[model samples]
Each structure stands twice: as C-alpha cells, then as structure tokens.
Target: MNQWLLYGVLALLPLAALSGFLMGRKHRKGKQDNRLSSDYIKGLNYLLNEQPDKAVDTFIDLLKVDTDTVETHLALGNLFRKRGEVDRSIRLHQNLIARPQLSSRDRNSALFQLGLDYNAVGMYDRSEKLFKELLSDPVHKNESLVQLLNIHQLTRDWDDATKIAEELQSSLGVEQSKPIAHFYCELAAQKRQDGDIKAALSNVKKALTINPDSVRASLLQGDIHLQQKSYKQAIKSYQRILQQDIAFLPEALPNIAEAYSNIKDNSGYRSFLNKSLDAGAGVSVLVELSKIIQAEKDDRAAAELIGNFLKERPSLKGLQRLITLHIEHAQDSAKPSLQLLDDIVEKLISKKPRYACHNCGFETKAIYWQCPSCKEWSSVKPIKGIEGE
Candidate 1:
C-alpha cells in the first residue's frame, strides 16, 4: 500500500540526517573518516536488508549529541511525532534530553517536543509538568501556555482554563476572550445542572460581561431565568440573542415561545416571531410562526404562509409541512395519495442533518456549541438549504 511506502521512507529520515551530519564534519575531522565510512556502510546494508529499525539504531549510535547535531535530532523527532510514531519520537527526544552537554536552548526545545509527544498520547500529567517547566523560557512561554490551556479544557477544569486564558490575553495580547466566555458558560452550565441557580446566574453574568455578543451566553442566561420562574427576564435574555446574531434566532425560538407561554403572552410571542421572520430568520422560525397561525385561524392560512415563503426560497421542510396541512382537509379518495406524498417528504427531511460546523463541515442532527470534529467554539449552526433550516 501507499501508506506502507510512506512509513518506509519516514523510517529512513534519521539515516539521511545522520549522513548529512557526518559529511559536514568530514572535512575538519579527516582522521575519523575511516570509522564514519564503515559505519555508513553498515547502516546502508541494514537499510538494504529492510531492517529500518536496525539502520536507525546504527545511525543514532554514530551521531553524538552536540551543539552542531542537536537540531538534526530535534527535527527527526518532530518528523516521527507527526507520523504518529509517538514512542519513537519520545525515545529520540529523551535520548537528546539525557545528554548533559546540551545547551539550555536545545534542552528546552527537546523538552517541548517530548511534552507534545506525551500530550499526543493523553499523558496529560507528564505533558503538563514538562510544559510548566518551560513557562519561564521566553521562546516557549506563549506556546506552553496555550498547551496548558488545552490540557485544562480536556480535563474540564474551567477555573484553570479561565486563568490561563486571562494570562494569554494580558501578557501576550492573544485574543482569548471568546474561549474565555465559553469557559464561563461551561461553568454556568455545570452549576445549573447541579441545581445552584444563584451560582449559575452569577457565572452567566460573568460570561456576558466578558463577551456581550455571545449568543451561547444569552441562551444559557435565558434558560437559567426560565428555571427560576423569572419569565419576563428570560424573555429579555432570549430577545438579546436576536440583536447579537440573527443567524442563531432559531436556537432561541422554541424557548422564547415557552417563556411567553408561561407569562400568558401569546400575542407577544406571535409578534416576536413575525419580527424574526422579517429579519431573515430561517425555516425553523417560519415553521414555528406557522404553528401559531394554524392555531389562531385555519390550516389554510398556515399553508398559505409556507407557500409564499417557498415561492421565493424552496425548502423540503416547508413542502412537507404544506403537504401535511393539505392532507388534513382532503377528500377521502385524495387523502391516501396526499399522505403518501407527505410521508416521502418527511423521510427526506428526516434523513438530512439539521446542523453543520462552519469550521470543519461536520454535520449532525443534534446541536453542539463546540464542534466535535474541529473542537471550535460556536462554529456549528443550523444547516441552511433545501433540506435544512
């Protein structure tokens, strides 16, 4: 297979680096040429025998770690790590780190590589300790902080993630507020699940203060207020999402309607849905608004609304809904055919994913604020197409 060929070539990278290293030293160290030549021949024989591990070992044994050869070792180790050969990468880096003659810069670089090797294999404690040691190294400080933040996130230590994010923002001028706000939202969600409404609200407020335009924060705040029977305040929080990002209006619509229902404000809910539709809300909003119309007037009025929208922008969901309304009032002979058509449209809509990640194109029927594939925050939105929204 092609993959086996690539692995074979990757296994020979250290041999190539060592050959280059020795040749660069040959002119100045003429007395050592005979031993170097013999060892090179032995390595080549090993490679020709398809014993790449023996070839690599022979090459490593010949190359001494020094100021001139440290970079070569680091590069080879990084290459191995990138190829998913973590054990080989870790061994190479450890070999380099074990040499006391290495300079401070070379040692720190090796440590960073080893930390990455550990991090790749989910050895977080080892990776965290190594990264912590490099926090004082000016060349690696910012990157080490970033890796530490990543570890904290994986471990679900939101408090630690927040601290690291703040440090990245203030010390390095890296834009971390978006992730930091998400961290607060994470903490708020935890507290809300634990039934500590007061603490949950406090964390949500902190998130909003950090990033006022966070749609997730607004949604979380609205949910928390709804749980506390603060229906009017919940409406305010849900309404803020429309102003922040109209694209996410669908996510808040069902909850907004629920909040209005709790307060006995059907008219207010209908008015809000109309405004959202005017602001270019998608098929979900249209569908919600159609429900209200059908309840208030008739199936014909609801079908008419979806028909008008589909005239300008086609949707499988809209067509399915429209077909269902017609089937409700059809003649007995026509009902079977209408029901069959509705069933076909319903299946088509059901098979399509409801959401997709903008960053990674990961599609799913359920919602995720952080994309599962790319690990990006707030990237997954409701999919917009004929079969979506």
Candidate 2:
C-alpha cells in the first residue's frame, strides 16, 4: 500500500467510527445522513474498481479534515512515492504538514516523507534538511542517521560520513568499520593529492585503527614510507600484507623488493622469495625467484629451475620464461630451434588473462582492487596456473 494510502486509511478509521455512530443515531430518530453515506460508498466503489485517481478524488471530497484521516493521507502519499509518482507524493505530504489538526509525531512523519520525496527528485539540500530534523528526534534517530550517512556518502562528504558511521555503530550496533576505513582512506587520498602528507598519514592511521586488516591502508602506509625513504618501515608495512592476505602478495612484491634493495638486503629478499615459492604461493613469486636466480646464477641454472618447477606444476608463463632463457643461452647452431620454442610459448601466454576477479570471473590485463564488473572490494587478483602469473 502507498504510505499516503495507509495514512489515509488510518485517518479514515476515526471518521468511519463517527459516521457509523451518526448513522446509528439517525436510525434511532428515523432519519439518515444519506449524502455522507453515499459519498463514502462511491469512494469505496471507485477503489474497488481499481480507479485510484477517481477514488482519491472522491475520498478527498468526502473525508472531513480530522486526526483520523491524516494517517490515510500520509499512506496515500507514501504509496505515490513508492510508485515513482513523486509529485503526487510531495503534494499529499505537503498538504498533511499544512493541517493544524496533525500532532507533533504526525507532523514529523509528514516532513520525513516530504524529505524522501525531495530526495527521490534529486532535491538533496531540501532532503538533507528534513532528514536532519528527523535525526534530532529520538524516535526516528536510527533511520534519520542512516539517511544522513547515505546523503553524505553521495555528496563525498567523508568527514560527515565518518562521524555518522561512528554514531550508527554506537547507537544501532551496526558494523561500519570497513566502510569507515574506506572513507578515511578516501580522505587520506584527498589529503595526499593536496600535498598534506601529515594529514594523509593521520587519516591512514585512523583507517588502520578502525579496520586493522585493511589492505589498502597498509599499501598506502607502505607507499608513504617508501616516498619518505624509510625503506625498513616500508618493508615492514608491505610484508604485513603477506600475513594479512597472501592473495595480494603480487601487489606487495615489487615494492617489497624495492625496499629490500634500498636497505641493501638482497639475501633477505631472496630468502623471502624462496619461502613464498616453496609454499606454492603463485606464479608471480616463481617468476620473481627465477629473475633473482638468473641474476645470481647462470641462464642454465634459472632455466633448469623453471623447467623443473613446470614439470611439477605446469604453467604457460613458466614455459615462456624457460624458452626465453634457452634462447638467450643457445649456441648459433641451436638459435633457430630455441626461437621457435620461444614464439610458441609467447603465443600461449598471450592468449590468457593476466588478472581475474575472484568474485565475478571478470578478466583483464590490469589489476583493480575493486572489481569493476561486480563492484566488490579486493576480489581481482593475478590469474594463476598454466597460462598466467
């Protein structure tokens, strides 16, 4: 039922009772209020015939302005709003608010409905004010807070979003930590763009405090430390991601390696890569390890390692790397044969996606923390197995 219709029905209850009483009195006096009864029956007939427009007109004409009918008017207004008839909803709610017979609670209800109508029509400023008014009322506090939060989020008002999230958590036991952390991260990004590193760092810390498992927060922290030349701190932050969620290891690898290089700790980097490879982390770790081995050992050793690993867990990327290594070390007599092998492996690897969304099976060459297809967070990851790393 439409909110306006429901309000109208509720308002009609008292009028209905009065009409019945008057009819009874008329019957005792051998008289009848035939006009009022006829109009009521006509309005009901229109409603039963599914002619809502005619029913509304008849009901409005027949129904007297009273506390009982106020609720019916609100219900009808809400129904119109639900049907995407915002103009009608707005008029009905506005009419209810103008009535002096409405109680304080009913008046607020009407205002809230009007606010929703305004919001539906994209009159955000007006909706914001009405929602704010409802927020001040204890009875509607939770709903008002929720609406306010949505408004702030739509407006990109992160500060207000954060505050309202906190309030909702405290008052309604709603878990807002993840979204709150994201909001803080958004603020941090804005601050960073404005060259306010200190403020950005503060927001990042706040994000971490709210949700310790936030990968984006850790990534941002590592990036800030890296920019400031605090390699050890950067390494620590990036390494934390491995424990937090190993699926993000690929994202952390390059930064981790850069930090280790800054600190002149090639041995530590090698050890980490070896451990990751041993644990069957992903093809990325295997590739990174192969690169390290190629630098420290010979092409033959790196090729052997990749070949042996591929035999156990075959991957197109591993095969491609192996072919490339062989091509690099091949004698002039074997050069043509090695080049053919390389071309075959390259074609195979090129046909596969580099990244995929775990949530939606969306494939792309680029990585997205949030899946563009499904709009889910931290779902897209490097494609694994035979064709990808």
Candidate 3:
C-alpha cells in the first residue's frame, strides 16, 4: 500500500466507527439517520476517488469523543504506528489517554500503544517509562515485559534483557532460551574484550547450558582456549562444532588446523581434514584438506584429490587450489600457461563472497556466526556455488 493511503485509512477508522455508533443510537429515535449515512458515504467516496486528504478532513470533523469510539480510536492509532506514522499515532493515543471518561483498561491500552509509538520513533527513554508503568498493571504485564525486553536489547543491556526474558518465559509461556543464550554470548564477548578471560569463559558456559547447540558459545570457548594457548582444549572445542552443526565446518577448519599445528600434530590435522572431506563436507573442507596433502605428500596427489572433489562438488575455491598445485609442478613448457590460469582462478575466488545467510540471502567476504544484515545467529555459512565454496 502507498504510505499515505495507509495513513489515510488509519485516520478514517475512528470516524467510520463513530458514524456507525451514532447511527445505532439514533435508530430508536429515527432522527437524522439518513444524514449520518450520507456523511459516511461521502467520506468513503472521497477515499475511493483517491482524495485521501479530503477524506481525512471529513472523518476528523465527523468523529466525536465518546465511550463507543474509544476502542476505535485506539485501534486506529495502533494502525498508524504499525505503518510508521508515529507522530500521528502518538497524537491520537495521547488524546485518548487524556480523556477522563476512559476506563482503566482502555487507558492502559492507550498508554501501551503510545509507548510502542515512542519506540518506533527511537524515543527509548519515554518508551521505557511508559512500559515500566504498564508493567505494574496486571492486565498488561506480559506484553509490557516483552516490550521491555526489546528495549533492553536495543540498548545492549544484556542483564536487563535476561531478566525480562526469564519473566516472559515463565509468565507468558514463550520460549526464550535461544535469545537468552545470545544474551550470555554478548556478555561473554564484552568480558573477553575487557581481558577478563575467566569471567568470559564462565558466561560462555552459561550460554551453553541454556543452548547446548549454540555455535556462538562453542566458537567463543575455542577462541578463549586458543588465547590461553591450551591447544588441546582449543582443538576439542573447534572439533565439537562439526558434530553440533556441519554448516560451521568451514569456520572450524582454520582454527582447528592452527591448534593441531601448535601441538605439532601435522599427521593428526591431515587425518581430521580427510575425515571431514570423506563426510561430504563443502569445498572449503576439501580445499583445506588438499593443502595438507600438498604439504605432506606431493603436488600431484593434491591436484588429483582436488580434481576428484571438484567432480563431486564443483567450486571456484577447489578449482583455484587445483590450479595452484598444477602451477607448482608444471614443466618449463607448461609453467607460463598454468601460472596464467592460476592467476585468473585466484582473482575469481578472491572476488567471490565466502559466506552467505540462508535466512536473508546476505553475502559477506568473511564468516560471521551472526548474520550482519539480519542479525540472526548461525545463519551465515560458507557460500557454495560455482563461484564460491
């Protein structure tokens, strides 16, 4: 819908309901019913003719403040807020709140809608007060708690968010474990940045307790272990990711290899990569495995492995790695042409994005546990295609 049209519809809603109410009250008296119906028809005619401004003016003049129209006014204000016309919605809702005749329930509802209007326009302080007020009202406790959770998330107040999430889970029966784990992960990240590794590890473990399959928690644990130079523990953490979610295999490979290298276990690293490849992992795993093969065995074996994998899962990264292997072993006659091909493949692979979000189709050159565009956890994974792996 056109934005203006949506606003116009919201503006006319209360007037339409008021007209109906007036018509119903006058039905027993049988007085001037035709006039009320005529006014409504004219307003609708203006809307149909695309004269939304005139329709809004007509509706505003026709609507009157009364109990019968309070719900209609609240509904209209909420519609405006949903359409992003926060100023108009706030005006309508605030007007409703000021009316002395409004019932306690209706008043609270208007306040809640006005709070949402403030939130929509980024007025967090004002929205926070209104939500806090609503939180005290038994009728709006659950909804208020949820909105407070959103506000806490926006402000990055993980502690407050965790508290409200727990309340929402218990009071409203809404599962919040996943989001709660994300909150702990955020706390862990903050602690890690502050050099409080012990506190960071504790928070990460709490995240895992909330969500055992949380890739973010595992990643953080591995990073902490790597920082402490606990190579075996880091290797264990990175390897756990594969069993938790195979889509994260690409993220674990480089870190896993580093941990193994630190422990001087080239043979163990090579075995791990081979196992990942045999499990039909993506081209990223295959490429890493091929590199290990080239380092340990020979260029020919690496090239052959890449060629066979490319037949099963064609990818630019795999092809680029294969070209590099061929270029290394090419004779004087074939060296220049192979080098040129290798350069072309390298350019192609470098230009392609390494990861993409399945939920939002957001592409990125680097891996992210949370999608940068959609802010969804574990959504961005290795991009697999002709120009990616």
Query: Which runs in model 2 stand beyond 4 Å of their true positions?
Result: 1-75, 278-280, 303-389
Per-candidate local distance difference test: 0.87, 0.80, 0.81
Top lDDT prediction, candidate number: 1
Error of 2 at 139 (Å): 3.4
Q: lDDT tens digits, residues 1-389, model 1? A: 36675579566965666685676576466646667778778887777767777787678767778887788788888877898989988999999999989999999999999999999999999999999999999999999999999999999999999999999898799788788999999999999999998888899999999989899999999988888889999999999987788778888887888899999999999999898888788888888889989999999999999999999889998898899889989999999999999899988888889889999899999888889899988788888778776
The positional error of residue 122 in candidate 2, measured at the CA in angstroms, is 3.1
TM-score, each model? 0.90, 0.71, 0.81
For 301-343, candidate 2 gives per-residue lDDT tens digits of 8888888888888887777788788876679999999888888
Output the worst ten-in-a-row residue range by lDDT, candidate 2: 11-20
What is the clash tally of candidate 1? 0
Model 2 quality (TM-score): 0.71
RMSD of 3: 4.7
Instruction: Please give the lDDT score for candidate 3.
Output: 0.81
lDDT of 3 by residue, 1-389 (tens): 68877776666666666666776777767765566678778888887777876675566545555766777777777766787777878888888888898888889999999998999999998998999898889998888998898899889999898999999999989888888998999999999999999999999999999989888789889989998999999888877777677667777777888899999998898888777766656888888877777777888988898898789788877887887777766798999998888788888878888888999999989877667788666677776678765
Off by over 4 Å in 1: 1-45
lDDT score of model 1?
A: 0.87
- Residue 244 alpha-carbon offset, candidate 2, angstroms: 1.4
Worst window of 10 by summed lDDT in candidate 1: 23-32
